[model samples]
Target chain A: MTSNASGRKNLTFISRRSPYGSGYAKACLDMVLSAAVFDQHVTLVFMDDGVLQLQPNQQAGDIHAKDLSAALAALPLYDVDNVYADRDSLTRRGMFSDQLAIEVRLCDADKIAEIIRQSDVVFTL
Target chain B: MTTLHTVNKHSLNSDLLTSCLRVARGGDCILLIEDGIYNVRTLEDLAARQGCELSGLQCCVLHDDLTARGLAEKDLPDFISAVDQAGFVALACAHRQSVHWF
Candidate 1:
């Protein structure tokens, strides 16, 4: 059942936009889940404004927007457990992994670049 | 080793289309979605204008996105193909790499 014969690869989905600014947050999550359903090895990276999506207690009632962080926390259920957040971005925003709803490994810029370089396919939203 | 490059902006509003064309390799696939369809009519014109040397590069647009923007199938240029969500996923799997330009 391995994708090795088919050469399926480590797919990277980068979410660099804010959670509430546009539909990009949902789009990025959808892409990772869809790719995972296809048995692709998927990793999700949140950087820049993207890290803001992981913030806790986001009440978007006024905008009637869905809670993106809730869905982001459900990635493991979709088999997309490789989630990364930029440390500098989180710090710049005065945030930490403890403030996020999901379990994400804090990575530096170099590590983030390494993930991009190693992925067979990357989708940035 | 062709890259399946996806640009989500329109040519008129952003240089992404031209930039993608500038760096595209021969036979590379360019999938335009979201506002990118707004530039479909200009592909031939863009090629001529920039003299982009990449040959046989396949250009496509997402059908659903086009409709969301009130563009129909007939609105797409003859040279540009319309692909669905599944086709988009398949396109990524078919290519060596997939890059989405913001």
Candidate 2:
């Protein structure tokens, strides 16, 4: 772990695209997984269209993409336990935490800003 | 300080690989991730030309991204090293900054 090499730097990946419309959501997940594999401290935030990524029963039936929810569920396994969704983003879409496919904390804009402030690197995928 | 130029597109489809190669300085290193791993052959060629043409340019690919795309590591030439996510973190830490060409 790089935690001891230097004070651990937090890398936060912000996902702003909906699932399956393009590669953005998957890219964010993959990048987060990579950071976690490197043993770097990392967090993932879903905002904007990204909130759709956590929606339950997502089916790419005809488009044929990997089941991203399964991967989201696997985040904790990779030590990426800080998955969060923007509260306003979710509310605007009429979504609640119970409606999500996986577990993620609902965060407001202020908290999102704080996380960004604390991050050494912020990747907005 | 060395700059880590990260390319995240396919060579056959995008110009990110060529652009990174053209502008990357002597101390800079190229890291292929996402679809960029498809350019391993191009990167290997650049690495092979280090002495006669290019100088001090290192190349590597993200192992997870490579395998996620169903690419085999054995096929990668000896010039490029496959690094895990932690290795990627070390690279980002060691370099002055990262330039991602999507």
Candidate 3:
């Protein structure tokens, strides 16, 4: 699982669920944070309904749920900087990158594959 | 390195299969398990609907799950293979990593 001489393993987390639908999205985020805290190289990819979690101005307070976006915003501070969103998913949802709550690198199918290929572990939810 | 993408939900009920196909690449293996076996019946149709090409992609369905769902090997399409439990483990070992789409 070691990609390089450094002891860090590449961990890729693919979040494919919408925020607040269930605990899947939140649970995945928790895993990502835990992995990052352990000093593993983390990559987060948002695709399918998971891209919906990136939508800005969420009114999650009305539903009595913690704001997922706020947790996501803290990812950068944790050194989990390899953030990406599927381009096709965003387009299918009529969401522009500029409209997302946080900045992320946009990736197409091939690019996504490249990232997954490089990863030593892939977590999906 | 190749990734083994496992899909466990039906496309009609969930878009997990479609989402799995979106990032699956050539040489990567896609194994359908549980309700995902239903995807073998309409994989091409769904891929076409989503405008995703399946060329050079390896697709497989769990034989046990297929049988459990009342499907037989004879009913499978030419492009997809029916793998047994042992084959499933082999596929997982063959790939560098695995991703589950549920």
Q: Model 3 in CAPRI terms: which quality? A: high
Listed models, DockQ each: 0.20, 0.02, 0.86
lDDT per residue (tens digit) for residues A48-84 in model 2: 6789888888776646778888789899899888888
Backbone collision tally, model 3: 0
Expressed as tens digits, the lDDT of each residue in B1-102 for candidate 3 is 888999998999998887787778888889999999999888999988878778778999999999999999999999999999999999999999999887
Prediction 2: B-chain TM-score = 0.85
True interface contacts reproduced, per candidate: 0.45, 0.00, 0.94
Off by over 4 Å in 3: B49-55
- CA shift of A42, model 3, Å: 0.5
Q: What does candidate 3's lDDT look like per residue over A56-117, in tens digits?
A: 99989999999999999999999889999999999999999988998899999888888889
- Writing each residue's lDDT as its tens digit, candidate 1 over B1-102 gives 566889888888765676566556666798989888788878778877978753578888999998899988888777788999999999988877777777
- Please provide, for model 2 over B1-102, each residue's C-alpha lDDT reduced to its tens digit, 9 standing for 90 to 100: 466779898877765665456446666678999989988877656434532234476788999999998887897878688999998999988875575666
Report chain B TM per candidate: 0.92, 0.85, 0.96
Off by over 4 Å in 1: A1-3, B1-101
How well is each residue in A13-116 modelled by candidate 1, as lDDT tens digits?
87877888988888989888899898898989887678999888888776898888888878889978789987877887888778787899988755655565
Q: 2 or 3: which has the higher TM-score?
A: 3
RMSD of each: 8.3, 12.3, 1.7
Clashing pairs in 2: A38-B85, A38-B86
